[model samples]
Target: MSGEEGAVATETPLAALGETMDLMTALQLVLKKSLAHGGLARGLHEGAKVIEKHAAQLCVLAEDCDQPDYVKLVKGLCADHNVNLLTVPSAKTLGEWAGLCKIDSEGKARKVVGCSCVVVKDFGEETEGLHVVQQHIKSH
Candidate 1:
């Protein structure tokens, strides 16, 4: 085999491995995985509780949260605990990703309005995506 062909064969594509997922999509994937594995906490109250307990691995907030105070509170908690924090554009989307939405007859997520915060206590076996997200946050 040629040298270039051998190198290409041994290399792994970042996108194929999920390393190329954007921050928002990575956050959603982590939330979904956490929900299924039992380490997800939804909403301000539960997220704060998790952060206060020093159990939060990552904290995700919605940029369009109606309550400024709630956003400040979660940001403070994340700062105090040194947990990784990320923000998405909308709480409704965040809620859907956090598994708070109900499936409609059309098989799409609906209702449940929005969630202001979501804490990921653990990423279970699917942690590479979360690590990539964390690295992205740290670099920015």
Candidate 2:
């Protein structure tokens, strides 16, 4: 193959692998993996503390959070600490992804409760999903 064609062939696999998962799906994978690895700090207060300490790798906020000040505080902290920030549409969905809510036998959240924020401290050995999430964050 020609030089240009060889480069394109090698790049194609990487591009495909990166695009295989959407942002939300990759985010969920990261949260789930982080949960088992004890890398997550659930709730706004805990998340803020993590960010303040510069121990956070990523911070996720729920778009439907009731407290605007808390969101702003976390945003500022993330910026100050150079941590990546992401937002999901619903707190309930975020709670589920963060494993804050208990799952029922029927595969549903036991309560209507939700967590507004989560701080990711470590991605553990499974860094692919985290890498994907960080790439998405950087691109936007």
Candidate 3:
């Protein structure tokens, strides 16, 4: 991530771990809120607002699934518009989170109405905040 498009990728495990930890915390917080509030609509709404705010400087990790169309659409649009897209390894965490999302769809749990959205929101805000702190610390 040293070349073009303003990439700043780091290959350090600790750095990646820190990112995961921070993101998990944010997800937990948002999940708790959604559970308490009895729906993922409010949670996703809050996430969208945060994502819109940090659209320029964030890499969103979307969970991959058999339904690649919708997954890539959301992530790709964000990327085409300049937001970064990172695909995560699909797992039960995402599935369970979706189950908790309070969606009324009978199709599948692929709706952007659950933990993935929460993680996207968490990634945006936390990553943006960390970047701001990094810039500040560097300047001073």
What is the alpha-carbon lDDT for the whole of candidate 3? 0.42
Candidates in order: C-alpha RMSD to true structure: 8.0, 9.5, 14.4
What is the lDDT, from 0 to 100, of the residue 30 in candidate 1? 79
TM agreement with the true structure for every prediction: 0.80, 0.80, 0.34
Q: lDDT per residue, candidate 3, 1-140, as tens digits?
A: 34643333422443566543444444443344444444332223453454466533333344644556655555755655655443335434543543543445563444433344433333222333344433543564
User: Which 10 consecutive residues of model 1 have the lowest summed lDDT?
Assistant: 10-19
lDDT of model 3 at position 58: 34
Tens digits of per-residue lDDT for model 2, 1-140: 59799779974774577556778988998898889899999987788888888899889999999888988898889888999889999998998898877788766777656888999998865556677787898898
How far is 77's C-alpha from truth in model 3 (Å)? 1.0
- Lowest summed lDDT across 10 adjacent residues in model 2 is found at 11-20
lDDT against true structure, model 1: 0.84
Please give the distance, in angstroms, between residue 94's alpha carbon in candidate 2 and its true position after superposition: 0.6
Each model's number of backbone clashes?
0, 0, 0
N/CA/C clash count, model 1 = 0
